[model samples]
Target: MQTQLAVAAYIIHNNKVLLIHHQKLDLWLPVGGHIDQNETPDDALLREIREEVNLEVEILNKLDLPVEGKTKKNLALPFYTNVHSVGDHDHACFYYVCKVINPEKININQKEIKNFDWFTKEELNQKHISENVRNQALEAFKLFEKLTK
Candidate 1:
C-alpha cells in the first residue's frame, strides 16, 4: 500500500482537548495533515494547526538535548505514532500534544473542517466519538496534565 508521512496535534487548553469534525471523512479527528516536502514533522504540525483553526499553538513535547552546534535545533518529539488507512492509501502519522497560544482567537476553516470544539476527557467517552480518537485524546490529556504539572 502507498503510504505518506503525516503529522497531527492534539491541542489542549484549559484542561480540554480540541477536536475537529472533518468534512471530507465525516469523522471527528485531531488537527493535522500530510507533511509537505522539505518540512519537518513539527513544521507540518504547526502549519496544519494554523491552516485549520487559525490559532498558534505550543507543542508540549520537548527535547532536552544540549545545543552542540549552530546548525542543530531542538525539536519536540511525537507523543505517539501509528499507521492507518485512508481509502487505498495509508498514512504514517506522528501525533503530538499542544496548547493553544491564544484560545480565544480560533477561526475554523469551514472549507476543510465541518466544525470544531473543545472536549473534556469525560466528553470523549460519548457514544458518538470514535474509539481510536477517544483513546488517543484521553492519552493526550493525561500527558498534558503530567507535562504541565
Candidate 2:
C-alpha cells in the first residue's frame, strides 16, 4: 500500500466554516489536495485553498520566526493530523485552520468541486455532515475563536 502526504484547510470567515462537496470523493470535506513534489506543506495548503475555492487565506497555526540560520522558513503547524484510507491507498493529511482574506472571492473549481457551503456551529450537527468532519469543524470553530479573541 502507498501513502501520500496531503494538506487541508478549514477556511473561516463571517463566523462560519467552509466545506465543499468534492466531485470525485462525493464527500463534504475541507479544501485540500496532495502536496506536489518540491512544494512545502505551507505552500501546498495555500495553493490548495486558492485552487479549490479561489480564496486567499492566512494559516492560523503558524509561528512567526525570523527565516535565518539553517532554517529558511517556518510552516504552519497542523491543528490535527491523521492517516485514512482513500480507496486503494491512504493519505496522511495535515489539517489546518485558515482565516479567509477575501470572503467574497470564493469561486468553486467546478471540475473538482460539486458544491460548497459555510456551516455555523449549529449547522455542523446536520446529518449530511459526517461525524468526523463535523467534529473537526466544531473544533476548528473553537480554535478560530480562541485565536481571534
Q: Which lDDT tens digits does candidate 1 get at residues 1-149? A: 99999999999998889999999999999999999999988889999999999999998879777888684777888888999997878999999999789999899999999999899999998887899999999999889989989
lDDT (10s digit) by residue, model 2, range 1-59:
89999989999888899999999889999999999999999999989888999999989
Off by over 4 Å in 1: none
Q: Evaluate residue 145 in candidate 1 and report its C-alpha lDDT on the 0 to 100 scale.
A: 89
Model 2: residues >4 Å from true position, as ranges?
Answer: none
Q: Please give the distance, in angstroms, between residue 70's alpha carbon in candidate 1 and its true position after superposition.
A: 6.9
Candidate 1: worst-modelled 10 consecutive residues by lDDT: 63-72
Q: Note the Cα lDDT for every prediction shown.
A: 0.92, 0.92
Reference-based TM-score, model 2: 0.97
